[model samples]
Every structure is written in structure tokens, then in C-alpha cells.
Target: MHRLKKSPKNARKTPHPKADIEAIGEGRRLAHLLRAKRKEITKAEQVRRILDTAHNAHEISLAENVIRSTMHPADQFEAFARLHHEEGMAAEDIAARFGVTAAVVKQHLKLGAISPKLMQAYRDEELTLEEPTAFAITDDHARQEQV
Candidate 1:
């Protein structure tokens, strides 16, 4: 059995396996724990978690991507929300696309405004969304009319 080392200060904590410690994979195996977490999870849970995490990550990533290019973050979220809409994503899902809570996305979605430029930036960066396409498009047509 291998003993596991404690995680760093900022890392999210994982369940410490009392028994698996000795058998855990030893390489600098945690390049990015999220990647490894993907490997360890079973299929049913994988989809849900990947989507959630992806959404959160995408939101932060989207913010940074716009700033680096000297673009407006508000405009960036709007554009992304639109493209995601094109791809059949829903308001809650679109909110997740940027890793924010549904309420947060709703605030952005209410505006008739969307940023074509930021959508382009999102595509250029190949950003990943946390919510799946299925959820993204849920009630989409209705929302489009409202928007």
C-alpha cells in the first residue's frame, strides 16, 4: 500500500482512500486533478460533474479571454450566450456555459443584447461549457422570443 501525500493549500480535497493509498498511481499523476477526476468517475456522474465544472471553468476562462484581448467582459458573456443559443443551449445552461449560477445567466439573458465579437473569441479559444447541449436548448425557442 502506498501512503498518499496531503494536497496543497489551494487544491480541492478528494476523498482520501484509506485502503487504496498503497495502490494509487504514482507519477506526477495530478497534472490537473480535474483531468484525473474525469478518469476516476463513473459515466453517470461524469456527465453531470464535467458539465458543472466545465461551466464554471468556462465562465472564468471566458472572462480572462476577453480581458487579455482588451475586450469588454459584459460583451463577452453576451456574445457567448448567443453562440451557445445558436448551438441549442438554454438560459440555465448558457449561464453554466460561463460557470455562473442560473440566476446570474438570467441577468445577462434578459437583455436583447449579445456580442458577436465575443462569440468569435469563445470559438477561437474553443471554450468548454459545463452544461450539456440537451439542457442548453431546453425551452430555448420560448426564451428566444422573450429575448
Candidate 2:
């Protein structure tokens, strides 16, 4: 009788001993963990490359524009309203962009007209949110300052 030896590829994947099988599973798990670690290291290296690279003039300009567009909501809305009004855009059109009624846009424009001191006071948390609205009810800067 002749015995035929199994090639490495054709050999049984699991050992007959339970301990050997468990060790093989653990080794597979460790290999998977190492692969994940390697992927994370590659991602970190890519981030470092992006941060260390010198940006061109256009890239810098784009970054500046993005930063400028990140103004506080109140200030940003006021600026948008003011520019729209200055550009002869209809109140209704501007209101559509703001997703508010024309009346609300008009009221916001009124609030936008308030003195810078009052606006700064509102921004500084020194005055309640309603205080600015009350000031907007009257166009008198003297009265607004008094409040």
C-alpha cells in the first residue's frame, strides 16, 4: 500500500486537536487586527500630507471666502438683507430666499437699522433677545440708546 501526502493547498484547514484550531483562529484574528492598524496609519499619513502641503493662491482665496461666509447668523442675515436692498432686489424675493414672509423681512430690516451699540449689546449677551425687537419698534436711536 502506498500513502499519498496532501499538498499544502489541499491539506485540511482545521487541525484535529481543539487547541491547534483555536490557535489558528486567534492568529487569523491577530492578522485582521494588524491590517486594520495599518489602514489607520495610512489615513493618518494622508492627513499629515494634506496639512503640510503649501496651498496655492486660489486655494488660499477659497479658504478665506469660506471663513468670511461663516459669520454669526444675525450679522450674516443683516448683511444679506442690506446688500439685497441696495441691489434693488424686491423685498418679497429676498424674503423668499430667507424662507420668511415679506413682513418678517421688513421687521428684520428694521432691526438691522438699530444702532451698532445696541447690536453689540445684543451680541454681548447684555440684553435679552426681545430688547432688540423692542428697540426696532421705534426708529429713534436716542430711545434705543436709553433702553
Give me the candidate number with maximum TM-score. 2
The residue-by-residue lDDT of candidate 2 on 119-138, one tens digit each, is 77876678776888888888
User: What lDDT score goes with residue 56 in model 2?
Assistant: 64
Alpha-carbon deviation at 10 in model 1, angstroms: 32
Compared with the true structure, model 2 gives a TM-score of 0.47
Q: Which sections of candidate 2 miss by over 4 Å? A: 1-73
- List candidate 1 stretches off by more than 4 Å: 1-71, 112-147
Query: What's the C-alpha lDDT at position 130 in model 2?
Result: 81
Q: Which tens-of-lDDT digit does each residue in 1-147 have in candidate 1?
A: 269666453122233234333322222234345555677643334331122343465554455445323333344455555655656777777666667787766655543242333233334553333222222344454453343
The whole-model lDDT of each prediction reads: 0.43, 0.60
Q: Candidate 2 at 131: error in angstroms?
A: 0.3
Model 1, residue 72: C-alpha shift (Å): 1.1
